[model samples]
Target: MHAMKLSAAILALLLPLGGCKLVPTDKPDAETAAAQTDEARMAAYADENWSTKVLPVIAEHTVDYDTLQKALSAGVETAGNSYGLRPEGEANPWNFVVSGAGTVTEAKLDSRAARMEVDMNGDGKPDVTLQIGPIIRGTALRDAMPFIVFTDFRDQIEFAKLARAMNEKAHAGLDIPEGDVIGKTVSFTGVYTMRSVDDAPEIVPTVIEVDP
Candidate 1:
């Protein structure tokens, strides 16, 4: 009986030592805050990368008006679609990255940069009309090539979002407030989408430099 009591006392002492308390392991507030900060930085970097690298790439590869005019004359399906045309893709008729600079003959008066005509040839004649938008519409710039696919962005939705962001950023860079760019000698490098030869080869310039 004495031995049994001794054994029972030892068991009781060991049981108390072998206990585990449930502790709630939750996400730390600091960790979440740090993660958000990092995400913001990454997003800012993406914007800058697109503006500096992607837009410029499109600009550098832009075809002149004469070449573009010819290409449009020849159907995009033919040998004309030379500079990475994405006509068969989602953005139909293809988005042509075009570069030209000349006097702004007219500006559609509005808060946004819409329907600004440019005399690209400087022959005292306006060859192509450009669209500067309160909302710069189209996915031509994004799909002008294969590199700027959904893989470049976070997802399919992000890809579209990137396009909108790019347009907004491009418009901001042009900075034609109150349609005051009229009669100014401005050079622009932007994207052109042509649905047909009849399509008014409107340029949506990613870059615009005011000469005078």
Candidate 2:
């Protein structure tokens, strides 16, 4: 009887210790790691598609300069959707592309802005002020909603990669054209933003066709 009581007391003490397993939570499993890998691959594919296909299409269909100018005169609320891509609320401080044929009357390659003067008409004054930049700024090319939707980037970093890829490709494409553009007639397409009618944009072309 004494041995039985001693055994019960030992069992009770051991039971509590065994029951308190306190298993530590494991790190992410193989399945979770595989899922993350698949997601990254998806984002990479989308980013490639944007640079190779989407950007070119958007460049091809840029709004004509005169048409855009006329539309902007009417006000962004009225013209925002019709002439250019508009986000949900404000289109101003937004970006859109423009295209036209012009003579490059002025070219300042070494300037901070790398400014250009293109006379779309025969008039003396430049209708379009352009920038061939050391760094391309503005969201006009990046803000194509349909393309952005198609990219389906899950995070800002993925989207930024998409933008940088497109911008670099465009900059490479523009390098020779910017050289040829000076004192030459050319057909060009570019992007700009409008805060108001008074906002002068330094339009920068993603594509430029030089006429021999």
Candidate 3:
């Protein structure tokens, strides 16, 4: 009888111990988690519509010879002044030569702001430009928005890894055209903030007209 009672007690102890065994719970897989992250990032990049808010503001400013010269000079100065220390054999305060014209190609709204491409001149080539502006109007609130513009070359490098991944998935081909590529459209992506001439903000002009 003692043995029987002991066995019953042992069984009861085992029952509770068995309950402690770990059981796997349903969780998102790695792929699912990655996809979720990508979706979130893409959404963040597309939240602002620059065409509706910012482009009109810049376009209204108008482009002329004087403005184009000023803008080009600004770009050159910004690039030259970058990194503080000048490298060996670097040209002294280089300036962007008027390559030609650029036109607006596509404007997509994203979380970061909006991406726009404009062909400053009427050539087939489009000058890549990005515009950042307020989603809604408010004085202090406007400061929160980010606006940025990039050259097509710069944009291409910026999106290189992502573009490559996209190409791999879509199996699309890229064309390489010949001749003077200086004026060719470049790609850029980033948030931008608007600043008046007095502030001397580092911004590429929206309207660029290349001089012949």
Candidate 4:
């Protein structure tokens, strides 16, 4: 009886020594969960709409490179209002859907943010730069699309995520070839922002075909 009492006392001591586990009283709310997965949600959004909506709209709105160049000569805002799009109620720069065939004068495929300079007017100087990226800059594609609106998203961060997701989706579609691309002819249809008339347009190509 004494030994049994002693054993019971030891058991009680051990039980008290065992660490307490925290049990959450409530599960995360829907809004909180969404905030945590903003990037993933935007990625899924881009994937769902890219082929069905984005590409078709871009194709429909594409202006010939030569025509756009001529329009740009008039003025940035003039060209933008005539041929490009800016999201309504936003002071975002004009984004253009442009198409052209050109010769690659320089290819910086070695860089993580790879790009190629293309000479469109036979001037042997770069007229437009094509981003061939593992990393792409800007939200030109997203901004150019009339259907994608900033107000439609949850917040600025979510809208920015949408832009990044679109860029990632676009980059995944490119089949960059091996070796140097200098002197090669390529035809492309893509989007660019008219940040400045003097700046060479940097295009994020949706469709780029290398000629034999």
Q: Evaluate model 2: give its lDDT.
A: 0.65
Stretches of model 1 off by over 4 angstroms after superposition: 1-48, 87-91, 113-115, 121-126, 151-158, 175-181
Candidate 2 local lDDT, 140-200, one digit each (tens): 5566544465236567765665555555455666744445456688677777767677776
Residues 36-131, candidate 1: write the lDDT tens digits: 643453445447777567766785677876776666566765523576456345446677787766788877746455777778676777777766
Q: State the C-alpha lDDT per candidate.
A: 0.66, 0.65, 0.34, 0.86
Sort by lDDT, best first.
Answer: 4, 1, 2, 3
Better TM-score candidate (2, 4): 4
Candidate 4 lDDT tens digits, 67-177: 998998999989988898878854778899999999999888888898889999998998889997868888898888878878888889989889888988887898776
Question: Model 4 clash pairs?
Answer: none
Ranking by TM-score: 4, 1, 2, 3
Tens-place lDDT per residue, model 3, 1-212, is: 99999999999988988669688876678655555544343333333434464444334322342344456456544533331112133442221211223444554434333334555446654433433322211121122222422232234444333222322211111122233334345332121222322322222332322222
TM-score for each candidate, following the candidate numbering: 0.64, 0.62, 0.26, 0.81
Using lDDT as the measure, the top candidate is: 4
RMSD of each: 6.1, 7.7, 14.1, 6.1
